[model samples]
Target: MAKKYVDINTLKYLLYDVYQLEEVLNQDRCEDHDISSMNLILDSVKDFSDRELYPYLKEMDEQPAHYKDGGVEVHKQVGVMMKQGGEMGFISGPFDYEEGGLQLPMMLYTASSFIQEAANNHLTGYIGLTLGAAELIINFGSQELKDIYVPKMLSGDWGGTMCLTEPQAGSSLSDITTKAIPQSDGSYKISGQKIFISGGDHQYADNIVHLVLARIEGAPAGTKGISLFVVPKKRPDEEGNLVSNDVTTVADFQKMGQRGYCTTHLGFGDAGECQGFLVGEANKGLKYMFLMMNGARIAVGRGGAAIATAAYHASLEYAKERPQGRKLASTGKKDPEEGQTFIINHPDVRRMLLFQKTVSEGSLGLVLLASKYYDLKHTLTDEKEKEKYGLLLELIIPMVKTYPSEMGAQSVSNGLQVLGGYGFCTDFILQQYHRDIRIFSIYEGTTGIQSQDLLGRKLLLENGKALQLLTEEIKQTINSALKYDDLKKYAGKLGDKLQEASKVIQHLIGFAKKGDYERFLSDATPFMEYLSTITLSWIWLEMAVNAKNALVTGKKTYSEEFYESKIHAMKFYFKYELPKTNGLAEVLLNEEVLTIAGEKEVFN
Candidate 1:
């Protein structure tokens, strides 16, 4: 059978060897789950996605959600998929058992989510919003608030959205003009227009819960004045029944991709005062939102990675089946006598396949590793270990979010190139994959935003503690590799790259501390790229080490071809991929490459 998604062998290697997800199941915090249980859950999720969700993918994108007669209408097929997903308890996987969740570890949950996302990206948005909402309420909302809303969201009886953007306040939250008037009761009346609110107003659920950021009356100005509110489409009565809350939809944005989800323009308190309850403390909206944003950001990155994996698989399948040309080395004229061979025989096609393999599998390996850190942060009982993993997560979050996103989009575009004209046409799936993956860099946060966050906040503000933790972890991995004969050479090269990356980061830190903001910001993207490349290289090396152990131990059954392919992927990344760091480091050290001083006309 043709492979429609990520290769199963690659998935097995990633889950067992690289991530060691089974080890996580044994952790005390994950006592609720064992490997068997987790595998069962994953199997169910994979089946649902393959059978129910994958079939509707093209139809959702082609038909899209449309706004008419005052309500946005999502495709009925998407609604069915979401309802089935909810029935399977996927939307609530990370929630507490008391709140209708499966009480699964975040690692297992995120791993399952990646399969669903790869199978169908458009429909995953609904689940994403639900998870985001559940997280926010569980973290900061009042007990009453959690009691009232958490279960409904988890069950998909209701949908949720984060309403932070306004017409004037795109990236600058401090400039928002949304007003919140304090009422005689403790609640406030929220009045404002919010744009780009994903899943803001959809018919998939009975009601929509908007986690809005607005300024309360008499509150201080700037971001400090902003507060988060749980504003629902309808107010629940004494009987806990929902009624119109006066929040109305003004319009829905017509977007370029991921059109299955509703992106609405919302007007709060238009018909009557929209009642809202505060979440957490006043003036700390951004901090609270960051909790949700951080999770969502990583999720978006994984989504991008998943799409790239799908596109690569699709292109590979097409290349293997479609007969096109002959081997370049063959001088035999017109193989018409022998019949045309498959495109896979062409060296150029092989090159494209290798490119897609490295980026897609490399991204999958990297993101899953990041999710493992998430599991450690939550599941580790040792305070020191938790803090250590937390620091590492902070340092790598930008890369995990930006690197896969940026590279995933590149991989999908290149996958299209491998297909030639068919890739450009709507008849093939690659065109839609290209359009879908393009949104990754923009959502969660822009690539530039992630770059600035890495250099400005993660690197500089922490005084290099996070980077130090990461270096120690990589060094430990390298030290372990010394015991393995097959991995020693690869580990040695990675060690050298680690040293180079660290020196560059240290120099940039010193430069920034000396008030060289221009020099510091100028090298930000290169620094980010260098760090990301090195991190992924380190992960690929770790996988290589594990593959060697698998071959030597003979503890499991696998073909020689599988291990050989794994080695090839590792070697390909190091040989063809790691050299980019040289250019990146050069860009950082030399001030000439800084584009800030370039003319505006040059930009044009």
Candidate 2:
């Protein structure tokens, strides 16, 4: 199989034609960039991935990251990606010029990241966590703290990780017991154990900085008491010398997949000497950490998208070349005497390939759409436009973070199936793709957590105005798609989904209105899948209409095959994938209360 991890043409189409990257580039924040400049960076990153990422993926996975000599030893490529990524501005692309960044649009940076992830997801985490942690410090840390931490992180001389999960708390962050005792010098003595910390402790960088969530001494209970801290593995001394802050790598967690990305159990203040500096105001830590979590959520979705894409191309290449069986005729007759035919000639194989394409491409589009909203939320000049974009971003975050993750995982599984038994074998990368993507749905937030968040909070955000804004946007797409005769049915189908979603939401809201919040959110997961299906349908329809218009106007950026392919995938999604909502909605509207804990024990 070819080393075709990502389709640059498809990425370009989504960014340039579908999402309109120029609209973002025209903004004051990105005025210095255009498509040509963006393409140059994309090409560079692709080349770098080819050289530094793809070939080494299996080797790293086989070797894996392990604890050695009190530090985690990752593949040497980890160091290469960090230094080269920092030199190429991958770590600081979206920061301002003065912040030692390229000052580029987030959309472009994310697109490049998709390529890197598809090539080697395990390696991508090293730099991604650094960038996210540094961004938190830049946004919320004091000037002195920023001066101390952000530059080194961005330069790849240091690494960063967010310490949130504990052995007992799991996802219930409110129950975290990490403590921060204030000192006379304004620094705090931090003590806690954070498990499942990715890129937590590695020998690839000189030092590691942790953005920790801890509670101050004598503060309120629960989330209200939490505060953010910049706790480094080695806090700097008065003469800028690096010394131990008593942060210890207690153990590295071995995983079933993403073998090269180290997840460690960290113990802070074992010697009662862990120094932590406060970030922003006290008790607003959750709020600030959420800012990075949202970004990490989208990144996780992109990880899913990238893995699915790589698997699709791998399976596709195999299908086109690997000959095994003969295809049946239109009359449903097969001749055993005939020579073997390529799997691509078989309808079933084509079906599997199309499913992979549909989920992978659509996932990329959904994530890019969210990134566009993010760029607009920050860059737009008008307050109203910024606010509108912000609301839209908030509303679709659950879907943007989840559809690609959950659906993309299923898509990769199907890709594995396409290769028959070889997909699960080490001869192919499909098995690794499957393992690497399984974590996204569980990372940042689980699918259930994201679902409950969407149906419970975002729908009611801003007095329900956030959902209203999304409705208007979807309707606008439907209205534009109505111009083409071929798209009318899809347009109508999408409009019906909107109505179905509205009805389902209203029915769920009734339970909320009656003060039965448990019943209101009982079916939140199904409702989330329902809403995500509708959103993906809307996304596909919008892209198909763009392709149709391009073909009609003869203003093709890609080949006619590409445009026609979009139309075919749109039809496939409508015919095969969209109807899934009917079953999900059925589950949502049945009013069955079997899920919530009841007065009597149900399960045996």
Candidate 3:
């Protein structure tokens, strides 16, 4: 069979069946929309992505934004896509209908966004930033602020960026030195330099709204003194028309990948002073910024997963079409009659494909599940249910953000490997996919940061309650799978893995309190990886059970080949992917190997 982009039917199955999005739509929060309507929106976006976005993907990577004279210029193609995306209403899907948004469920919105990301990742960054900014305004800004900003942003007349990182303070928000001084008006004058700001400066939109984090004058040091401000490139008047603002561009960064979106160094107060309004309360900037960061983190994770999925799909197509050496068992050497078989016939190629499939699909399923939880927390009528969903989301955020990021990169790398020498060349999209996906594990919070957040804050502060809740959910999933014969053995295996993972989590918690904090922290990344493996395994098993039920009941029509492929992916995950947890668990239990006291100069 000819290789193609992502299998649309498979995507539909994963979204509607595996994630139970239809059931989520029936919830009170989404009572206004039905599955058909949601599907229509998604189908349109998918079609647009396939036709309009995918073709420019390679060109955008090759012709990244260039810095000149005091501003950055992105590929002209990006502007076209941005305008099309804006016109399609994708930039405002989750906002209120009165604000020109479709008011779609978060799950559906995320699913649609995933298609765009898969088609062209760098182009998608613009939309991600815009959505993040709009969300920050909706959550924290005043009614007056919303009146001035939300409609313009929703209409795609403007774009947004998060300005938090500095040359000195990269990840340590507390160390940031950006200054915000109060003016006669309610607004503040923000003066600072922010670096690595994505979508920071672009011609695609009329103006750029920067959600900046800066400290107030004479305020106590660290994050407590920091406040979030709405700093626009051109300050809007009472009627929201553009007015002069003292925002300047210091430089634009040339990155390793995702070049279509401008990463820039922005200087405020360079010309004079940038007028800004406080978001939320003073000295609580980190709190408000976290709301946006958390949302962006999930978005980055989903972007990583989408890139991996696209690469896998592309590689799968390439493997099936590209003829190579015959199967290993074919001993006849020089038989021109036999000719060359497709690379898919090779075991190594199959291994790479399976690895990509397991990671990409599993990560996609996990992210969609998390997005559904976001919807449930906001939409569910039952207070306790909402609380449960919220806690679960909190516990899973680190995993959802980090796991897909770490594994998604690995998946894309394997995808490149599937293409042999072609994968290494710039001519193929796999190379660009690898470059684009590599940033996932680093941005949004490095894997290390997420690990510390997971163990230090999420697990420890809650007295392990969040983790326990997640364990129970996995247990319930396994319990439900017991009735299905196809999944019984896999469920038992998953149960054992979960039990082992649970033990590791408990042991790590006890170790942390024993004053061996360094030793315990040393294993945080591995522990996170272990937890992610088990969690994704449980999710894949749940999906497998659903697939099996569908197959048995004949409720949904599927080709024998497709059903077999689904079963193969599930088995590949369990047989090949799940067993790695034991090794990760071993490392968690014995942290001594990593805690070896060595001087930094020793390696040098």
Candidate 4:
């Protein structure tokens, strides 16, 4: 089978036609960019990823980062690739030109990242965190801090990590015990341990910058007292020479996948010498970190979509090339000479492939849509427009983060199944893709955490205005799609889903109003699952309508099969995936809370 990254045609259609990215580019913030330049940037990244990253993906996975001689040793290729990415300016693709960036629109950057991540996620992740780290400094750091740290990080001369997870504290960051003491020179001495810090300790860069959250002495307890700090692995001395800052690597974690990058247990101020500079205000660390977290969460979603896309294409290639059992339609035939039929001709294999297609592409569209909202939220001058887009982004962030992650895992599994026994073997990358994407749902925030955010907070924020705004957006899509003969059915189905979801949410709100908050959120996970399905349904309908319009109006530049495939996948999603919401809604509407409400003795 041929090696693949992603379907370029579908991406072009989504960006240029469905999403109308050209319109976005015309906006003041993105007016400087156009399709041609964005395409060139994307092509460059793809070419580099194909040549440098894809070939070394297996090597990186096989050669996991190791703890040797008091330092982490990753595949040497990782350093080379990081430098390659840095030189290509991908590390600062969305930043301003003055910052040595291309200032590409986020939509274009998301698409570019999709291709690169599809080619090799483990390697791409090394720089992904660096971009986020740099963005934090740009958004909230002092001018000096930004001037010093952001440039090197953007250049990939220095690596970056978000240090939040500790030995005792995982997702509940309020429990973090990392301490930062004020020093005489306007710096703080950071002392604590952080675990699962990816790319934490490596020789890929000249230095590593850690965006750590620590508490100052005499501060209040919990997350309210946490402060953000920029702690570098090596700090400059009085002569401006980089020296060891007392940051130590206690250990490296061995994971099931993404072995190319290092996840380290780091100890700060073991020698009582580690120093850090505060970012933004003290005790506002969580607030500042969340700025990075939201973007990282969406990036995780894109990662999930990218890996799933690679799996789908690989399996699709395998199915077409690898001859297997006869199609079920040929059951009564006795043509022995005909031999085995291609597995793609079989309905079951097609089902699996379509599922992968709908999940991967639909999730990709959802993420890009959220990114558009993010752009408008930041760049729009009108306060009302910014506020509207802000609420829209807040509501969809969890879905855009978790839906692709959880569903992409399932899609990859289906892709693996499509390849039969060969997928489990090392001859193919399916198993690796499967392994790497498992961390998508687990990291960023678990599906459970996202579900709670979606239900407990997003739904109730501003007295339910966020949810109303989201529904209105969905309604607009429905209204636009309702007139299309080919899309009306899916549009109507999506409308029903919105109504059903609204009712379930209202029912949950009733419990909350009565102060039964725990019970109100008891089935939040399932509710999130249902909402994700509806959101994707809306996306599929929107895409189908766009495809239908292109084909009917002769506006499509691709072959007929290209447009048909979009509609086919949309139908597959509506017929097979969207209906699952009914059962989820049923569970949400029911009052029986067996998991949390039942007696503990019942389990035994």
lDDT agreement with native, every candidate: 0.82, 0.92, 0.83, 0.87
TM-score of each: 0.96, 0.99, 0.96, 0.97
lDDT by residue (1-604, candidate 2, tens digit) is 3558899999999999999999999998888888899999999999999999998988988999998888898999999988988888889888998878888887998899999999989999999999999999999999999999999999999999999999999999999999999999999999999999999988889999999999999889999999999999999999999999999999998998999999999999999999999999999999999987668888988999999999899999989889997878767898899899999988888999999999999999999999999999999989999999999999999998899899999999999999999998987888988898899999888999999999999989999999999999889999989999989999999999888888888999999999999999988888888999889998999899899999999999899999999999999999999999999888888966888887999889
Most TM-score-accurate candidate: 2
Q: Tens-digit lDDT track for model 1 on 46-146?
A: 88888877777788888888888888989886577557777788788877677677778767777788888888898888878877977888899999999
Query: Looking at model 3, which ten-residue stretch has the lowest summed lDDT?
Result: 1-10
State how far residue 276 of model 2 sits from its true place (Å): 0.8
lDDT of residue 228 for candidate 4: 93
What is the TM-score (0 to 1) of candidate 4?
Answer: 0.97
- Which should have the higher lDDT, number 1 or number 4? 4
Position 589, candidate 1: lDDT: 72
Which candidate comes out best when scored by lDDT?
A: 2
Error at 443, model 4, angstroms: 1.2
Q: How many residue pairs clash in each candidate at the backbone level?
A: 0, 0, 1, 0
lDDT (Cα, 0-100) at 369 in candidate 4: 88
Q: In model 2, which runs have C-alpha deviations exceeding 4 angstroms?
A: none
By lDDT rank, best first, the candidates go: 2, 4, 3, 1
Model 3, C-alpha of 456: deviation from truth (Å) = 1.6
lDDT tens per residue, model 3, 1-604: 1135566777777778877788788876567898889878988988898788888888888788988887889887667766887788888888777666777887888888888888888888887788788889888999988888877777677888888899998999999998989998888988889999988887778898999999999988988898999999998676957886888888888888897878899999886668888998999988887865656777878998899889998899899889987665456454666679999988889999999998988888888888888888888889989888888888889999998889998998998899989999987889888888888888878899999888888876467677778889998889878888777888899889877876887787786779877766777888888889888888888877777777778886667667667767888999988899888877788746534476554453
Off by over 4 Å in 4: 328-334, 597-599
